[model samples]
Target: MKKNYVVMDGNTAAAYSAYAFTEVAAIYPITPSSPMAEKVDEWSAKGKKNLFGSTVDVIQMQSEAGAAGTCHGSLQAGALTTTFTSSQGLMLMIPAMYAMGGQFLPSVMHIASRVVTSNHHSIFGDHTDFMTCRMTGYAMLMSSCPQEAMDLAAVAHLSAISGRYAFMHCFDGFRTSHEMQRIEALDYEDLRGLVDQEALQAFRRQSLNPEHPTNRGNNVNPDIYFQCKEGANVKANSLPDTVQHYMDEINKLTGRDYKLFNYYGAPDAEEVIVVMCSASETVKETVDYLNAQGRKVGMVQIHLYRPFSVSHFAAAIPATCKRIAVLDRNKETGSVGEPVYLDVVTALNQAGRGDIRVVGGRYGLSSKDTTPGQIVAVYDNLEKDEPKNNFTIGINDDVTFTSLDYKEIELPHPGQISCKLWGLGGDGTVGANKNAISTIGFVGGKYAQAYFSYDTMKSGGLTQSHLRFGDEPIRSTYLVSSADFVACHAPTYVSKYDLTEDLKEGGTFLLNCPWT
Candidate 1:
């Protein structure tokens, strides 16, 4: 079977999948997530057809709140609706999210998960934005990279339609959202083939039209409101199976295995790390490196976060797992452990796996790179008789002494060529690297990955481009700590930054400077 491979970023991949299933898109521009809506709008303008055989009606709203309202109204009128947002933009949609979910509308919101501005504002990626919505009656699904963003996005839509639940399909902002990679493209035919048409028509028949004449959203007293809220227990309980069914369909089409909880590394691993979002990619890479070195380690990557299935969590863990580290990407202040950690503990206790020692660690808050080095520290921590609980990684927590000691280590990728470039923000370095990755993947017939890191400053901020390509697939999700080639596009960076600190010995160095 031949595949149609395309070079694209997570945003484009999400938009491509969303466009196939969406009939109406209510959009509000937000960093990282904006590209998804922009792509959908662009495609609709070009007269692209969805599975419904018509162009999607794209509406640009004044704010995320308005966009969500528009999405809710569209879904009520029997249109399959979608919206793209992140950060505070997602927060503004909470009121509407509850309404849609309660009505059992199958609206898929594509979220490029970003840092929810706490004391300070940041436009970077993190899980705080979406994790805050865990109680909002939506089934959450996360993708670690561009390919999963494309594939799982379809599962989110199909499951939402079939299960009659709202779905938030989230990918790490900037990390997965902007990183360019080559992936198998899913055509509209694939989505149409997988979608349950009868379920979709059933949804349409329940629309708020004169022909339907249904009553909804009536003000209720405490007597029935409590019972009404609890009535969704059956639907919520069945969501895991619904999501898995679609995931299996996608596996059949793409030949890539996906589960609610996907495990990687040794089957009889003694130590395990459970994590979600883009950080899972880094953990998986580290697990492979450790297992090759004869260490019994493994990782469990979460897909469907909401409607937390304890059975699936227990089934994913190996019997030999003596210690488990649950890593959360977001920090919940004043809480004993972050969301994922708490869930893992609950799942273990509920599943009668309380014998396994479970430790919780926080990493990648506000998009901090969760490197192989940090992952190693987690495994090392697990080795201790009394491992550190509620610990931190990837940063020096001098005040609290909760950070694990980690040495910088790079995972080996055979035949892979790594390159790093430093430039000023708005200097077009990121654009150039994106184009380069596309060329390498498409023209050069190589698998490539590119990630751009920069500060919150709109312009004149420091920026770095990490690029890698090889004959084989690239799974290195963290920043390139060791590069075969290093380049400094801004002359000032040569003096301020340690440009060649990680450059490989006998490697090429390119300097862009005025003075010879």
Candidate 2:
């Protein structure tokens, strides 16, 4: 089957989907998520039309709060409005989020999930930023990678329109937001067919118009305030089905199956790990490796995080599973467990499956690498008589001794070629490799992925570019530990760092030197 494939990063994928449905996009610049707003702004300037047959109205606001305010007002005025933000920007949008939810407005906020700055500032990927808005009444949906970012964004917006509730479409910042991959692009015509025209007409009819002159946002007495809040219960309860309906529509169009919770690995697995976002990709790889070696291990990848569907989650879990490990990307101080972990335990209890021994662990904070080795450790921890709760992985926590011991395990892809390039952050190596991967993926008709890592001082700091090409989808989320090819674009980098340490035994190493 032919697919209109395009090479893009998570931010671009999100921008493309949001642009298809949005009539107005309120914009504010923030790292990772900024590219999404930039793309929408660029497209709007170029007169790109949405499904409504008109170019989107791109409005740049002074602050994230103002941007969110713009989206709320536009949505109230009967426009399909959206905004892109992350980290502190999401924090500033809390007030607007409450209003959107209370009014049951169909607004989709695209977020490149980032670490929330506390003691120090970090512009990296994690669930810290997205977790803060859990109680704001907006339904949360997570995308595991660039492709899902595009697909799930459509689900978020489509479901929001039909369900009359706001949706937060989130993907990991930097890891996904900056990482480029080849994905099947969605056409506006395909999207237009899936839209709920009746629901949209209803929304417009309910809009604040001079002809209608409807009163809203009126102060309510305490007598009926709680009861009034309960008015949204029916919509909230039906949201999971609403989202699933859109996801099925997307699957019919894209030829990819999606669910509220996607289960993978052994059907009768005794041990399982539950995770969300990009880490799910790495865990899937580990599950395949372990399952191949006769381990009864599996994984439950979450797509719809908000309106957490207990029935769907319970159905996704194998009945044979005896032990479960839950990994969350964010850390919550003084809490018994992180958000996802708490939700999983509650779902299990509600499903009357509380006999399963469950443990929660934290991993991949601030875009920390979550490798297969660490995933193996989590599975190993579940094998213990009493698995450790509130444990951490991918770090040696000697102070608290809460980290599990892990053995390095390498899973090789037979057809994929991995390449690594070392260069300065501002140098053209990253951009060159990005182009190279896009050419290979699109022009050459091959699956490809490219990810770049740099330090805090980005301009002059060391940068490592990881590129992969294969006949099948590339699931390696972590840095290239053993590359088939290695290149050093900087002359002096040979002496400064062990650049060839990760190169394969028979890999070719290219170095730029004046003498050579």
Best by lDDT: 2
Every model's TM-score: 0.98, 0.99
Tell me the tens digit of each residue's lDDT in model 1 across 307-346: 8999998999999999999998889999988999999999
Write model 2 residue lDDT over 1-516, tens digit each, in one string: 358999999999999999999999999999879999999999989999999989999999999999999999999899999999999999999999999988899999999999999988998989999899998999999999999999999999999999989999999999999889999998878898889999999999989999879888998899999998898888889999999999999999989989999999999999999999999999999999999999999999999999999999999999999999999999999898999999999999999999999899999999999999999999988988888999999899999998988877779798899999998889899989999999999999999999999787889988999999999998888999889999999989878899889999999999977874
Candidate 1, which segments miss by more than 4 Å at Cα?
none
lDDT, residue 284, model 1: 86
Q: Which residue pairs in model 1 clash with each other?
A: none
Q: Cα RMSD to native, each candidate?
A: 1.1, 1.0
Residue 429 lDDT, candidate 2, scale 0-100: 90
Candidate 2 vs. true structure, TM-score: 0.99
Candidate 1 global lDDT: 0.92
- Per-candidate clashes, comma-separated: 0, 0
